[model samples]
Target: MRIDYVINKVAQTHRGQSEGDVAQAIHDQLRAVGVVPNGRQIAQYANAISALPQLPPNATKR
Candidate 1:
């Protein structure tokens, strides 16, 4: 799954929250879009993202 995309999408509205909090936000958004992840899977993605390097910028203007 595109975990990074989901995490960043959720982060736009939930700044300054813990990874767990972010994970929950992501879960809700996914559900809203009818994409239900496995139980606790969002939290797992959140934890995984925390250990990886930061995501690159969305798209730079020329």
Candidate 2:
């Protein structure tokens, strides 16, 4: 799987959720797609996603 796809998934599911929650959600999503990622890896992704800057409400893709 692409890193960008994982990043986007993590960002989408991170809102109003704790790190553990995000990790579990990501785990489930990946599992359904046959990618059994390790817990530590998922945790790292969650942590990294949380560190990303939040886009403004009016922000647009360019």
Candidate 3:
């Protein structure tokens, strides 16, 4: 699943933290999982998170 979907679901399921908090938790979890290695990688993750709606998946024929 996309990160934002996962984050929104986590936020809803948690039912207490703000959306930002949920996003942060996902970001941290990603880092812990070696999804990112450094600041530049984090930037890539940030852009991915921010543009979740606008960017279409490359999996679609293009």
Candidate 4:
């Protein structure tokens, strides 16, 4: 599975959600698909997603 793509997609869909909320969403989604990530991994994914540059309000994804 392409985890980076997953993270980005989750971040986009959950925009304006809290970091923890987003993390949990990612965790749940992965678990549904049988990729059970632990809490630390979820936190790491959250941190990595948070570190990405934010787009302008009117910006569109390519």
lDDT of each: 0.66, 0.70, 0.50, 0.73
What's the true lDDT of residue 9 in model 3? 50
**Model 3 ranges off by over 4 Å:** 1-16, 37-62
lDDT of 4 by residue, 1-62 (tens): 65656776887776555678778888878877677677888887777666656645765645
lDDT of 2 by residue, 11-45 (tens): 86574466777777788777777776887888888
Each prediction's RMSD to truth = 4.9, 3.8, 10.5, 3.6
Candidate 2's C-alpha lDDT?
0.70
Superposition TM-score, candidate 1 onto the true structure: 0.50
RMSD value for candidate 3:
10.5
Q: Cα deviation of 27 in candidate 2 (Å)? A: 0.4
List TM-score per model, in order. Answer: 0.50, 0.62, 0.35, 0.61
Candidate 4 residue 57 C-alpha distance from true site, Å: 6.6
Q: Give the TM-score of candidate 4.
A: 0.61
**Candidate structures ordered by TM-score, highest first:** 2, 4, 1, 3
Q: Looking at model 4, report the run of 10 residues with the lowest lDDT sum.
A: 52-61
Model 3 worst lDDT run, 10 consecutive residues: 10-19
